[model samples]
Target: MIAIGGSAGSLPVLAELLEQLPASIDCTMMIIVHRLKNVPSDLDRLLSLKAPIIEPEDKQPVLSHRIYLAPQNYHLLIEDEGTFALDYAEPLHYSRPSIDVSFASVAEVYGPRALAILLSGASKDGAAGMQRIIAAGGTGFVQDPASALFDTMPLAALELCPEAQAMSLTDMVHFLTELKMSAEHDQ
Candidate 1:
């Protein structure tokens, strides 16, 4: 499983990363992006140019080769059985679809099978979540702060977990592809 975290200045980076990724890379991708209330965009339509995208139905099973985006006004979490759990609970860090919540959930459920990616964003919403991924023996990757359009989120992740692999957006895609390949070979 791969959990992606981002907020402000994430659209371009996300699009680019998705475009570069091979369609064959098999893994469940969960994206936690911050958005305003009553202004929800069709994520499936927006990202369809890149890969297979879906807005997970409530409690839908997580599947490989698909991308899941958090719905409006909800925090999307992963369950132990590879399914989604959407909560309308109060926002964390002033964001409803918090990256930290999704990452932490993946850490608890998938543990070492989880791969957390922190992308460009304005705040430090994902820092603690990245730490949880590490503590759970999962791999954590943060976009290189110098390369990010907004450095705060990635920088915070680096500060919180210095051992994380920080890379450019292009490199991050390559790394994910490699990780997927490795997992497939192991299986």
Candidate 2:
């Protein structure tokens, strides 16, 4: 499983990633982007142009080769039974669909099999979750602070999990390409 957390200045970065990704991958990808309460988002539609993306429904099974976007106003969570669960809990870091909540849950469920990427944002929401992921033996990656449009989020994540590789956007694209190739080869 792969979980990507982002806020502020992250849409363009995500767009770039999706634009460069392979047509298919062997794992499920969950995208957690901080969004305003009650505001409608076209993120899923926008990204679907580049890949098979959707705002998942509660209890929907987590399936490979699809990208799941966290819907606005609710925290998107992964269940132990490999399904999705939406939460109406209080916001974290002043954001619902909190990146931290999603990351933490993914780490707990997927452990070493999980891969997390923290991107540009103005808040510290993803730092502790990245730390938890690392502690649980998952791989974590942070956008290079210097290149991020909003560096705060990446910097915070790096501070907590210095071991998380900090990569430029270009490098991240290449890394993901390689990952996809490897997965295909294994099959």
Candidate 3:
């Protein structure tokens, strides 16, 4: 399982990452991005990859090679039973679908099997979550601040967990390519 979180200035980065992912990549990816309250989102239309991307319904079973997006105004979580659950709780860090909340759930459920990516943003929302994921033995990746359009979120993650890999966009793509190769070999 992989959890990816971002806020301001993250859309383009996410788009590029999605576009570059290997066709045979085998994993379930959950995306948590901050959106304006009550605004309509076209995320499914904006991002494209070989995997099916959808706004997961509550109780939907997590499936491999799928991309689940956190809908606006809801906190997306992974249940212990490997299903999805949406929460209407108050926003954290001034945003619903809080990266921290989603990442925590992923860490608790997938543990060492989880891989988390924290991207460009103006807030520190994803820092604690990255810390939690690392504590739970999951891998954490923070986009390199130098390459991020907005560096706060990535810097925050690195501050909390210096062990987390700080990667440039090129490095990130290369890492994913290697990950795809690894997955193919395993299959």
Candidate 4:
């Protein structure tokens, strides 16, 4: 499971990442962005233009080579059985569809198989979740603070999990592609 969480300056970065991903790459890709409260949003359409992005249904299978984005005002989670769960619980860090909530669920479900990516954001929403992933023996990728438009989120993650790889957005895409290639090779 690959869970990416970001806010503020994340849309462009996410778009670039998706645009660079190979169509044949195999893996579950999840994205959580702290967006404003707006119904009938076009995020799924915008992101799906680059990749096969979906607003996952409850109990959806953990399918590879597809993209899942958290719905506005809802927390996206992976159950222990690898099913998708969308919750309407209270917001965390004043952000619904929170990074921490989603990442923690991924940590509990996939453990070391999970990879959490904390991207550019204005606040510390994703730090605890990145720490959770690390504590579960999972890998984490943090956007380099220098490259982030708002460095607070990534910096907080690094402070919590200093061993996390911090790199530029382009390097982050390369890292993800390598992971996909490695997985295919292993299979």
> What is candidate 4's lDDT per residue for 1-187, written digit by digit as tens?
8899999888888888888887666778789999886667889899886666899888888787788999898899988777889899999999999999999999998889889998899999989998999899999988889988999999999998887889888898888889888988899
Regarding lDDT, does 3 or 4 come out ahead? 3
> Could you give me the TM-score of model 4 versus the true structure?
0.95
lDDT (CA) per prediction:
0.86, 0.89, 0.90, 0.88
- What lDDT tens digits, residue by residue, belong to model 2 across residues 96-125? 989899999999999998889999999998
Clash counts per candidate, in order, are 0, 0, 0, 0
- TM-score of predicted structure 3: 0.97
- Looking at model 3, the pairs that clash are none
Candidate 1 lDDT over residue span 60-161, tens digit each: 988877888888789999877778999888898899898999899999998988889999999999999989999999999888999888999999999999
User: lDDT score of model 1?
Assistant: 0.86
Q: List the candidates' TM-scores in order.
A: 0.94, 0.96, 0.97, 0.95
Question: Alpha-carbon error at 166 in model 1, in Å?
Answer: 1.4
User: Residue 163: error of model 3 in Å?
Assistant: 1.1
Give the Å error, residue 184, model 2. 2.5
